[model samples]
Target: MSTGGGAHAAGLIRLLQSADFARAFTLAALGTGFASLLIGRTAGSVTLVTIVIALDVVGAAILFARRDELTLLRFAPTSLLAFLAWTLASTFWSFDRASTLRGWFELLAWGLLAIVIAHVRDTLQTVRALGDVMRWMLAISLGVEILSGILLDIPFPFLGVAGDIAFGGPIQGIFGTRNMLGFVAVMALITFTIEWLSQSISLRLSIFSLTLAALLAVLSASPTVLVIAVAVGAATLALALVRRSAPEHRRTTHTAIGAVVATVLIVCWFLRHLIIRLLDAASDFSIRADLWNEILDWVRPRPVQGWGWHGPWLRGDDASAPYPLNVINFTLDDRHASALNSFFDVLIQVGWGGLLLFGGMSVVAVVRSWLVAGERRSIVHAWTPLMLVALLVDSMFESFTLTGLGWMMLVVCAVRAGQSRSWRERIRDLAEGAPGGHGSGSSQDPLSGAR
Candidate 1:
């Protein structure tokens, strides 16, 4: 009777960690993502954000209770907590203390949400869930763009619509900017390619996904994203080749990479002037150069803690730098907020200390993610790292590191790539043989694995 009762209790606990919960939380995450693109502190959007936080709260509760697969320590360890703590502390020094404090909460909340996702997913489910999110987001974006451009011929206020295709658009799609749209397309291209290479989807679907991603990328007309796409594509191809090589020849792959890096460094040193000239050839970049010069002057005074935790390009009354018009000598009522470089944005917002922390975090994340992705040639290995690369590339031209999808992506990838543990994890280690846990008992029969 005791043995039967124990078995029944275990079964009940397993039921609490069901796939149904996974599905629910996944959709909740998607909804939060969609709502975050809006303009405001409006109640509706706030409600959606609350839903995301609530789901995270519930997820953490369930996993913690089950002693199933919770990995809070590995997911958000000392570095992560330190970063969050510092960010929160900056509220005291912010120009607008209330806003900065709120930002801290918002960022931490998203980080928690990421931990929930990373702990819930395994390798395959991670990829599949990623696929579902990107596929549907892209599909919906296409529909919305078409409707705004052709049918309604007006912007959708809720989607943060900038303008329609009738204007020779730099079409902003649902993301509210041409560059952001291109960023999504680039990610889709990477993910869809992985799906294709992995044979996770039908050939026709893969081809269609590839074509759609390409179309969106081109139509968005974002020079930065296009350039980044080329770099990422080259990297992907190189890594793919590395994966295809035999295990015995894998060492040669590292040798080739080292050689290429050396040659590139040598060439860069020899032709530094020409490289500068080539970079200067872009007209828009020249404008940014002019502004950056002025931005440098303003940052000189506060090189330690910075102007405050305040971010974005538009410096209001209490901003660290001069107004965009003052910086660039351009006479336009509209303003450019970000420094066109995320690194500089961090420098101006939080100072050298913040910059070092953020920059270090970014570097560590990319390296960790790269290692994880290089473990195998499968799309699973490729997907997360490619996204990290895209994030890195975009940060060069946009202050994306502290905002929206970029921040969320960083947290998820970092947590997933990490390998750490808490004391409570002993409970998990002991429960490894249980269902929903990962250990030697996992998926020995490929046919029995979850689809």
Candidate 2:
């Protein structure tokens, strides 16, 4: 009976290892990633969050089972490894060991999710499946935002469930903050735009969804998100213009547009306070400046390793400092003081090495995605460059990395969507093990594989 039971168990494992099961697993991971954001801080720990965590585990298992079949990791840069090494090294000297450890753990989880997404999704069908999951996820969030806005008693509408309705409050559909909801909305907008452009679905439906997503973004009222949306839209239009002039200019046009957008965004961020003051909406700018300066001062003394993970930049006595205009109406805490910019947050906690790793990974991912898209010429390739531009633009003024759910979604999308290899590369992969520079199949020549 024991031997029979063992055989049954093994059979079940094999069944779970099939393509259909793998697809389901991927969907589950996406769902979990989405759900985790919705649940926010109330969901408790990893052990307590059974459903979402289970999905994450299942997704990880599915990828591990088929690890040998995919070549996704070959595209990742060695700088990523260096970044992880730097993060790990900081743990030993972190001023706040607990917070640092927690951050490191979260980073590790994100890295695993990225790898799994890249590995398990190898076909266009899988890519479509992933995209579908994203669409549905965004749709659900949009629906909640609309519903909550109608029902909630808050001024912001559909937000401000937790505590005071300060600083735009929490959208609370599944995330902890309004900013998180805004990020998700931005992501949804990007996906919807891609679908609309690709003509993958009916034009009417695409337009409706895109419009709905844009409305949701407006309602979320995330200033950083608004900035990203405008920048991405402008970048897309510019690319469209350049591509119209010459057919061969498509790749060059996208690259040039991306560079221009990045440069403009970086410059704008450096003068964010001035820009906001000029616009007569200096609230967020003032708050960001206060936090930025404090974090910068905190990090200057320990440039290398940082204060070590969630390191305390502010003490209880520091809470009396003036709050940013945006959050001035609400009660401020020391924690809020240190939680300004994601880039600065990393710099203060993980040091310059961490910043380099974080920045380098993003650049590498964007470039690699562009190169792959140039070769593949598929919807994903087109979508990735646009999405990367959006993310970079958004990161300038927002702390997306610490936003939890949205960050996970971005990482998953980036890994899976950006993993598309070129046709030539695919052919080379298949030919690597063939005999006499050709496969033994009586169907086609070795060179035919390149096509």
Q: Give the number of the best model, judged by TM-score.
A: 1
* TM-scores of the models, in the order given: 0.78, 0.75
Task: Give the per-residue lDDT digits (tens) of candidate 1, residues 1-451.
Answer: 9999999977766665677676567556654664466423345555655676776677676566446443344545455666676677777776677666656777777777776766666545655666667776777777777888788888776566645666656676667677788887887787787788778889998888888788778777777766678669867876776777787886788689769857876986798557546645366666667666766776787787766664554433244423322443344222566677878777776778888887777666666555445554445666666777787788877766566666777777666555422223435766665444322222221111342
Q: By summed lDDT, which 10 consecutive residues of candidate 2 come out lowest? A: 442-451
Q: What is the lDDT of candidate 1?
A: 0.65
Where is model 2 more than 4 Å wrong at Cα? Answer: 1-10, 40-43, 46-53, 71-77, 122-159, 162-173, 238-274, 277-280, 311-334, 413-451
Error of 2 at 235 (Å): 3.1
Instruction: Score residue 358 of candidate 2 by CA lDDT.
Output: 75
CA displacement after TM-score superposition, residue 13 of candidate 1 (Å): 6.4
Clashing pairs in 2: 37-174, 38-174, 38-175, 100-309, 149-158
* Local distance difference test values of all predictions, in order: 0.65, 0.57
* Tens digits of lDDT, candidate 2, 1-451: 9999999978776765676776676676666666664443445444334664465577566655555554534433356557767877887886456655656666666556655655555434334554566567656755555545455633333233342223333344445455666666777677766676666668887777777666656656666676777777785677456535455777677778779878987998799777676645577677777767666666777898776664223323333222121132233333463455667767876788789887876776666555544444345445666677777766666666543444554464455333443333445646686433311122221111210
Distance from true location, Cα of 447 in model 1, Å? 19
